[model samples]
Target: MLVEINLLPKKEPRNLSLLFAIVTFSGMILIGAAFLIWQMNEKKEELANVENQVQLTNEILEAKRTKLADFQSASSVQELEKAIKWAEKQPYNLVYVLQKLTKILPERGFLTEFNLEKDSIINLIIQFDTKSEAAYYLNSLLNYKWIDEAVITKEKAGDWEIINNKTPLSDDQLTDLAKKNFFPRYYAEYEIRLNIAELKQAYKSEMEKSKEGNKGEEEGGDSP
Candidate 1:
C-alpha cells in the first residue's frame, strides 16, 4: 500500500451550526417587531373613530336644546291670546255677579246650586227650613232690582228623623209622628230672568273704559 501520511495537522470539519442558528434567530426577531408595529397602528385608528362619534352626538344635542327654547316662547304667547279672547266674550264680571247674588240671598235660605244660562236666565236650587220661606225668597227675588222674573219650578220636603232612621218605624209610631204638626226641610228650585238691559246700561261706562285700555295695550305691544 502506498504511504498517505500528511505533514500538516488534519483540518477539522467546519463548524457552521452556530452561524446558521444566529441568522435564524435574527430573522424571527425582525418578523415579531414588524407585527407589533402593525397592531399598534390598528389601535390608534380605533381610538380616533371613537372620538369622532362622541363629537357628533354632542352637536345633535345642542341643536335640540335651541329648538325647545323657541317652542316654549311660542306656546306662552298663544295661551295669553286665548285668555284675552275668552275674557272679551264674557257678559259680566264673574266676581261682581257672585257678589250681587250673595247679597240678595234670603236669611232663612241658602243657595245649593246656581247656573247662569244664555239670555241672562239663572237657575237656582235653594234649601230652606219651610216651604213658606222658599215662597218668600221667590217674592224677594222678583222685587229685586237686578231680577226681572222669578218663579219656583220644583219643591221637595224631607224629614231628617225619617230619612236617618236605621230601623223601620212601626205603623203606630208613624201615625203618632204624623199627628204632630212637623215642618220638614224644604228644597226649592227657582228660575229667574236677570234684567240684562238695565245691567248693561249701568255698566256701559266701565265697559267702555276697559275696552279703551285694552286697545291701548294692544297698540303698544304691536309697536316694537
Candidate 2:
C-alpha cells in the first residue's frame, strides 16, 4: 500500500473585529460630512444678507446727496435776487454824504445856491462879499480831499439884486445876516453826487454771509 500524504494549509481565523471597526468608522464619517454641509449652507445665507444690507445703505446715502445739491442751487438763486434789490436802494443814501468842499473860508464868504444832480455831478452857485473872499473859498474847496475835481467855472462879482424888499427885513440887512451866519467857515453851496458803490459792495457781502448761515442751518437740521 502507498502512503498518501495530504499537505493542506489551514486558513487563520477571519478578523471579524477589524471588519466591525471599519464599518463603524465609515458611518461616523458620513454623519460628519452631512453636518459640515449644513453649516456651510447657513454661512452662505448669512453672507448674502450682509451684502444686501450694504447695497441698501449705499442707495440711501446717494438719495440724501441729491437732495442736498438741489437745496444749494435754490439757495444761490434766492441770494442773487436779494442782492440786486439791495443794490437798487444804495443811491438813496447820497443825501447824507458830507462833502466838506470849503475847508477854509473868509468871514464874509457865504453860500447862495446848492444844486445836486442825479448824474453824479456837483453844481455850485455862490455870491461873495469880495473877490478875495471868493478866491479864498475856491482855493480851500479845491484843496479839500472830498472834492475830486474843483473847477471855478465863472468867478464874477455880483451886485446885490433885490428880489423882494418885504416887511420882514431889508434886502441889505438880509444879505448881511446871510454873510454873518456862515462867517469864518463859509461854504459855497455845491451839489456833489458820489459813486458810493464801494459801501454797497460791503453791505452785499454781509447779506450774502447771513443767507449762507441760514442755508447751513437748514441743511444741518435735515441731517439724520
Candidate 3:
C-alpha cells in the first residue's frame, strides 16, 4: 500500500552528534562570558582600593605640613624674645651717657675735646673765663657718682685758641675768649682727664683705709 509513504528516510534518526556539538559550543561560550565578567569585577575592586590609599596619604601629608608651620611660628617668637632679653642686658648706652655729661657743663663753659677711651678714661677739655670757674667745674665733675677720679692735666692762657686742628676761636675783648689780666686779654683753657667706674664697695673701703692711715700718721706725729 502506497501509504503517504514515510517520505524521506525515516526523518534521519534526529542527528544526535550535531545536537551534542551545538550544546558543547553553547556551554563553552557561557563559561567564557562568566570568566570575563569575574575579571572585570576584580579589576574594579582593585582600582577602588588604590584610590582610597591615595586619598589617605594626601590627608596625612597635609596634616604634617600644618603642624610644621605652627611649630615654626612658635619657634620664631621664642627666638625674638631671647634676642630682646640679650639686648636689655647690655651695659652701655652712649646717648644717655652723653646727655648726662652735657647736663653738668657750666653756662659759660663749653667743651672742646671730649673722648672716651677703651679703658673707661675720659679725656676732656673745657674753657672758661677764669681759672676759678674751671676749678669749680672740675670739682663738680669729681662729685658725680660715676667719676672715680678727676684730675686737671694742664692749663693754658691764649688770646687765640686752636680748639681743634681745623677750628680756631679768636678770643679778643669782643668774644671774651680771653679776659684781660694786667698784661693782656687771654682765655684760660683746662685740659682734664678722668676715670669713670663705679664700684661702690671698693670705693668705700678705700676711703676707710685712707682715713685710718691718716689718723695713725697724725697720732705718731703728735707723739714725736
Candidate 3, 1-224: lDDT as tens digits: 57575557554588989999999999999999999999999999999999999999999999999999999999999999997785465354444455656677656566777665543566767666555566777787777666666777778754333332235533334235343343222233433333334533435566699999999999999994
Q: Is candidate 1 or candidate 3 better by TM-score?
A: 1
C-alpha lDDT score of every prediction, in listed order: 0.73, 0.60, 0.64
Global CA lDDT of candidate 2, please? 0.60
The model with the greatest lDDT is 1
Number of clashing residue pairs in every model?
0, 1, 2
Q: Which stretches of candidate 3 lie over 4 Å from their true place?
A: 1-8, 93-224
Q: Cα lDDT of model 1 overall?
A: 0.73
Model 1 worst lDDT run, 10 consecutive residues: 170-179
Q: In model 3, how large is the Cα lDDT of residue 130?
A: 50
- Candidate 1 at residue 180, lDDT? 64
Model 1 vs truth, CA RMSD = 15.0
Q: Looking at candidate 2, what is the lDDT of residue 72?
A: 89
